[model samples]
Target: MSTTINSFNGDQQQSSSSPDVGDLEKHYIDAKAFILSATTKDGINLYDHLAHCISQLLADQPREGTDLVEDISKTIKSEATPAQHDTLRDRPAPDSEHSLAAEQKPLFEKVDHSEELDDEALQSPLPHILEQAYYFEQAGIGLGKDESYRIWLALKQLADKGQIDKLRFWGKIFGTQKNYFIAEAEQNVDDETDENELHEEAHISDDNRHPNEEEMDDEEDMLPKSTYKPPPVVPKEERGTGANKYTYYVCNHPGGVWVKLPIVTPAQISQARLIKHYFTGDLNKEITSYPAYPGTERNYLRAQVARISATSSVSPAGKFKFSEVN
Candidate 1:
């Protein structure tokens, strides 16, 4: 009995040490079912699933620098070398004709105004003017040397072209968009004839007619002059007198086109004093303001220039004695 009891205890110890075959078989079956279920849900075979897991593990592993360089090289090798060569070969060459034309073009246009300029005109007084200007500059009352030189050239050109008897730089007037470089000149007036004088003479002769001669005319009898007397006419100012003594030419710059402003009338001067407006650099622009201006912007500018000159211009006392003789 003692031997049998010892043998039974030995069997119990062996059973506890060894795993059960049935339990091992059940665990294997459960693991196989789980893998099948996962594979089916993922829509891949077990071999493919195992391969994907292996690839992920390999990807997660750190790569050597040489392996990274090899991958970049492979990517570069995939591009078409023939296509790059074809693009370079097909590019158009630069235009030689356009370059040649640009090279041949002249930098500045040639201007010919020789026919207009007078050959017998007096030589330019630039040297004398420059000396005087230098003196004025020392006293701090003159335009700078550069500006004076440019203006002198412009004036000299004007004198030659216009056959002016005398020319003077009349300073500059600032405007909104541009400034006017003024040149006051005494031009030969032999070619010009004032039509106003003829009209005035005709009016004077008509007024001086006898009353009997007026009644004898049938046209005069037809007209009724009961009322509506016209305003007294302001006599037209003579040129070479007062503000009209010199003809004024204006330009946007020293070398620009010179425009001769119209003669200023007394009415324009009176009207200009009633209102103020900034210059628009346009000659034909109408002055629109209270007490409507009788003329355009050019007239207003001339009137103002005259007004300013009369008030501000100075001269050395007894510079020249007034002469009544010819």
Candidate 2:
């Protein structure tokens, strides 16, 4: 994930007043770490604070940065309504034409800043940030709806260093309502914790607090979670391939938890060669590989190479040569 931030330094400078390359890298790297640690209650509050800061930065005009104190000083003296002052205090005027209220659309809106970048930033920094933010969340960073917006702000700043239309650019991440789902899932998990606590309280009187229960709690806290077992591989008939069809490989995941690659027959590769494109066989059968780290699930890793690893090869595992795929 940190490597993703490093790619920003390679971007061509878009503006003289743009954020320094080193500064951008440091901020994003720090922000990624901050998000990953934000699952606790205090951690969540700190995350929202960072999101608020990012929102303030987005509201400011290009290169001016956010100056809420000065803006409020001027607002108090002007004839602006109390409501207008409140709004300005939160967000500066957007680079594009839109009211502050409209600019703050729900997180899943169709807005994207990648289209606003020059070729270099578009192809490089912009995508790098998006990919990092995505995997960061998938790695159980647990970025809820609110924290996810910080990702939007970061991308917008990278795209048009001096200008971003808050309204026009306001859209959902990856064009999906995933943030909504993530928020709902978090709420459900939190509710379960509360329910468990209530159950414990109802059963235990003040004088009868079980020493065994306390010991169990401490033991549970000390123990690490077990290895995640993915759903049993149920090979689909249509996508099935003979064991000898193509060279098979597993992700060289550092933790030694790896999945079989979906069978791509030599015939399929041959046809793809003639067409000069990768073949999308049985699009529904794609198998995706998630970040190969502890505590991450393969299912949670979206946009992974899901298609290739649909079924395990019939050939003996760990018997293939890397040169065969080449």
lDDT (CA) for every model shown? 0.69, 0.36
lDDT tens readout by residue for model 1, 131-245:
7789999999987897777677666666656657667887788888777888877766774455744654575568646467455565644655557756765765666777787
> Which stretches of candidate 2 lie above 4 Å from their native place?
1-118, 121-124, 162-326
Instruction: Give the range where candidate 1 is weakest over 10 consecutive residues by summed lDDT.
Output: 100-109
TM-score of 1: 0.51
Q: Pick the candidate with the highest lDDT.
A: 1
Candidate 1 ranges with C-alpha deviation above 4 Å: 1-122, 125-127, 192-231, 313-326
